[model samples]
Every structure is written in C-alpha cells, then in structure tokens.
Target: MVVTTELVGLIHMTTRPFHNLLLPRIAVLLVLGALPSCAEPAAPVHGGAGTSPTQKSRPPEKRPDSSYRPPRGFTELQSVAGRVARASGHKIVWRLQPGANPGPLVRIRGTVNDCTIFVHPLAARKVPPNTWAFLFGHEFAHLTENLGTHSATSPENELQADITGARYAMAAGYRIEAFLGWVLTEPDQKSDSHGSLHQRVRAIARKFGVPWRTIERESKRAASYRAGR
Candidate 1:
C-alpha cells in the first residue's frame, strides 16, 4: 500500500512527545499489507491478559459521539468489538470516522489506560465481524504484551501479535478459519514491519496447533469459493 503524505505526517506527529506524557503506541491495520511503527499519545486504561473466558460478562458500552452520524454497519461493528473486548478483558473506546481513505483499516490510539480504536466507515461496512475480531485481537495483543515499548524487531512484534491475537479471537468464539480465509485475499507482499501473508498465517496456525498445510488448503478453497461467486 502506498503511504500518503497525510499518513506520514500523522506518523510523525504521533512519535513526538506531548506534555512529557508517555505516548500510546498507534497500531495501524493496513488492509493492503503494510505496517507502521507505533507512536501516539492518549490517556491510560487497565487491561487484562490470558485467554477470554468461556462465559464473558458484558461490559458497559460507551456511546459514540453524538455530533457525528454513524455509518452503515456501525452497530454490527460495535457488537463484534464489544465481544472481542470482553474476551480480552480490555476496556476500549470505539470511534467511526467518515473517511474511506485506503490507508489503515483501523487505527489504535491511546495507552493501555485510555485506549480508543478508530475504524474507517468503509471497513465497518465491508469487513466481516470475524475478521474484525482478528484485527482487534491483534491490536489488543500489542497493548497487552507491551509490544510497542519493547526493543523487538518490527516483524517479531507483528508475529507475536498474530499468535496472541488468534488466541483472543478463539476465546471470543470467533471462527479462526474466517480470519485465515480473509488473509488469503490480502496481498501476500511483506513490508519493513509486517511479515508476509504466509508468515502471519503460519504464526496463527501454530497458535491453534493447526497444521500449516491444512489452513493453506482450506483458505485457498474459501477464497476460490468467494471469487467464483
């Protein structure tokens, strides 16, 4: 994916320290297969670790800003996000933006204490709930594992997130196969930060103790079926 000037500017802004406060790591989910380094500022919120419980307690949902009208499928996105958050035991604030730019499908802001996930309206309408679970799971893994502040390489951070995120998705009862299927449709190219599609798929499969070849076969079939339709 081509990084626009606006995104570059935003990235620069996020990296700068503001008021001597610790900046939250901004994890961007690139739909077209690029990844950016994390650097952003936001307040704090408490989060938990480990897999989600079989039965989860519903947390109080935060209402969106009244000034902006929600896009189509926003409600469904909220529902799915809530489930993922509960499964991860994290309190997240969700926002929907009107821009349909081909930059990031989701932008995570804020530290562990005050985290907000910004989703583009286009992603809300177009991506499936199960896929969103994996995306959310990946970001939450970053937050929970403190991958942003660690000295690990970018690819290492991303691979770790993929493994932990798959666990979170499973705990939330979302189908892992759905996420694998979606990955099949994404560009297989690698970036300076994110791994190639194959690497991510293998990491996630290992998390579930699934054979790489099995997932590869199944995912291709699923992708083919969707394409044929």
Candidate 2:
C-alpha cells in the first residue's frame, strides 16, 4: 500500500497545473534567450548581401533637353532651299501658286503623288530654288519611305531626313556642313514628338564635317547656284 500511494503522489506532481504568469517568461526566454553570453550577430559578409539588384544600383535618368541644335542663320532660309533643290536626284520644281491653307509655316517637303518632286513655295521669297532642292530630296525620301503615312510621329525618321538634306547637298558638290548648319531647324509646335533642335543639328554636323569657312563662303549660294556647287 505504501508503494501504491507513492506512485500516485509522483503522478500528481507530474500533473501539476501551469500558471498563466509563467508562459510570458518562457516565451521571452525562447525569443531573447536567457544566457547573457550570446554572441553578437556576425557583421554581414558582403556589403550587398541582402539588397535587390535594382535597390543596390540605380539606373541613370534621361534629360529631355540632351539633344542637338545648330544656330539660326541670319539670311532667309529660302536661300539654302534653292541650293538643296538644285542638287536633288529628281529636279525639284517650284512655282508661285497660292493655295488653300494646309498647315502653318511648314514647307511641303516633297511631291505627294507626282513622280517629279515638287515643293510648294510659301512665298516668292519662300524657299528659293536651291534650298528647296535638298529639302525636296529629303521629302522624296520621306515619300519613298511613306513617312507622311506610317512613321510620321517617329523622331528617328525625321532625323534621317536631316541627314539626307546634308547628303544631297554634298552630292551636289556644295559645302554640306555650312548648308546643314543653316538648314537644321525646328518643326515649330508641329514637331513636338521630334527630337530637339540640338540633336538634329549634331547628327547633320557629325556627318558633314565640311569646314565652317566653306559654309560662310558659300553662304551667297542662297540666291545663286555654284555649279550645284
């Protein structure tokens, strides 16, 4: 009987009640640890151990104005038009015909359907014969590419035309860079989606490294021809 009673007493001790107050302390020990000798967390092995790649390194932002634009010329732009027109593959035909208003001060760069390239003169002094030729070639390329239809808003295409302008002038044996310096201009409000003036100017200038003095000397070709020179 004594052995049986002792067994019961041990069972009672093993089944003793757990107080609510003891749980918090146990939880704290499990979380924080009771031992004061716990080592400090080891320093990170590498500086970028846990960061996302994007968070670790940011990409560069683009500036809207980071484009090219050449300076404005003093003389009327029509002068360059004459020279450009004279140099184009297809002869650029010009005539003083007043018509229904199409758009603002924008030039009609190429012939729409007609085989012979033509640009409507804004005024008699509009784009002189020479300047219009190169512009005509540019427009002709555009017409060929169907730019007026498919990629009208694309900035890159217009830039290609700018390059074409300088190229045509060079092919005509004129000083390409000087004419480009004058010809590289803005599209006014109509050209919002186009690249800025500086970028266009630079693209042309980079292509035609023709000397500056050549441009100045040939400046008079605005109203006159220099052997398509």
Candidate 3:
C-alpha cells in the first residue's frame, strides 16, 4: 500500500488526527489511491510482461536519523527489506513507526532517487519473517516498477505488485506459499481500488504456478499454529 502527505488533509476533514499522529515529514505518493486499512492488501493487474528485470547494484547506505532509535527486532526487518531490495535491484530506506495502529507497509517516494518503506511496530512484531519478505517485496515492486503512475487503478496496481512481489521474494529465497497464506488472512472485500481476497489469491496462484489448495492448506496450518501459540 502507498500514501502521500495529503493524508494530513484527510485527517483534518475527518477530524481523526489519531490515525496518523506520527506520520513523518516525508511526502509519500500513492499511485494506488488511499488504502482503506492496514489489513487491506493493495490492488491488482494481469499479465507479467511489464515486470522489470533486477539490476545488479549496491544497497544504499543507511541515512542517519538521530531522532530515530532502532526498535527491538528492527534489524531483522531491515534484513528482510534488504533481501527483497537486492532481489529487485532497488534501494529502500526502511523505517518503523511507534504506534499500535500505524498504517500498512507503504512505500514513500520522496524523489525518483529516494524510496522508503514504513511499517507499524505491531506489524513487525506480529508478522513472521517470511511474510515480511512478501510484504516488503510488494512495496519493492511498487518502488522499482513505478506502478500506478499511469492509468492503472488500485486493483491493477495491487495485482501487479502481488505478482512482482512474489517473484522478487522467490528470487530472494523466500517461499511464495507464505505470501498466499498471508493473503488468505486478509478480508475478502472487493473495493473500488482493490480486489477481493479470493480474486487476489487466484491471481497470485496463477502467476506463481502454485495451487489454490496449497495456499488453503498453508492458511489452515498457519491458523492452527497461531491457535496453538
């Protein structure tokens, strides 16, 4: 998912400053429109022809932010982002925000050369490492491919991200099934900008050559594991 600083206006219009109280100064551009909620996955598109090839390049050095103290387990998340970024041949600046209900994993493009991803603390703690690869991989696709910049709607943008992200994560050595399982957990709602969960599942399944039954099995296993925990 992607968002821009215009969210400030949205906050004011809704009189709901609490939702984005800690939003950074960075200006984020969302080609896929405003996301409904953190749990909601971004939109979709068909075909794999437009996917960008991964170029070999050095990962960008971390920019120092004295006010930013790395949260516990942040290093691990950074590692996941690094793996995805390397596989996509894009430099990403990863950041964690302090909040119980912060936004989804979103990519912020301050400029053509600057791309950053921000996630909630809860997401970092609750989502497993393999799933993180999928999440970051999704945002990495948006950043590298410059998706939604043209006439694509939210569903088109999100579907494209799903396909590209799965490829990048797979290239980075993460299981594609993990992403399908994660998608199964999302609410199956079809919105103006995003597709229903089932639609996304089918799209991703077709793209990765994975069976829908396999994804369903993984989802059940994940649920059982969580229940046991």
Clashes of each: 5, 23, 7
Runs off by more than 4 Å, candidate 1: 1-72, 91-100, 149-153, 221-229
The digit string of per-residue lDDT tens for model 2 on 122-216 reads 22222233343345455545544444422234567666765765466567554454444334322212244455554555556666665555544
| Worst lDDT 10-window in candidate 1 | 3-12
Candidate 2, residue 70: how far the Cα is off, in Å: 22
Candidate 2 CA-lDDT value: 0.38
- Listed in order, each prediction's TM-score against the native is 0.60, 0.41, 0.62
Q: Candidate 1's residue-wise lDDT over 38-126, tens digit each?
A: 22222222123542442134352332211111222566566666777778766655443434344456656555555566665444544
lDDT, candidate 3, 32-51, per-residue tens: 44422334432221123553
Query: All models: lDDT?
Result: 0.52, 0.38, 0.53
> Which candidate has the top score in TM-score?
3
Error of 3 at 61 (Å): 37
Return whichever of 2 and 3 wins on lDDT. Answer: 3
The residue ranges of model 3 lying beyond 4 angstroms of the native Cα positions read: 1-72, 91-102, 105-112, 149-152
Each model's Cα RMSD? 14.6, 37.5, 14.9
| lDDT of model 1 at position 138 | 73
Query: Which residue window of length 10 is worst by lDDT in model 2?
Result: 2-11
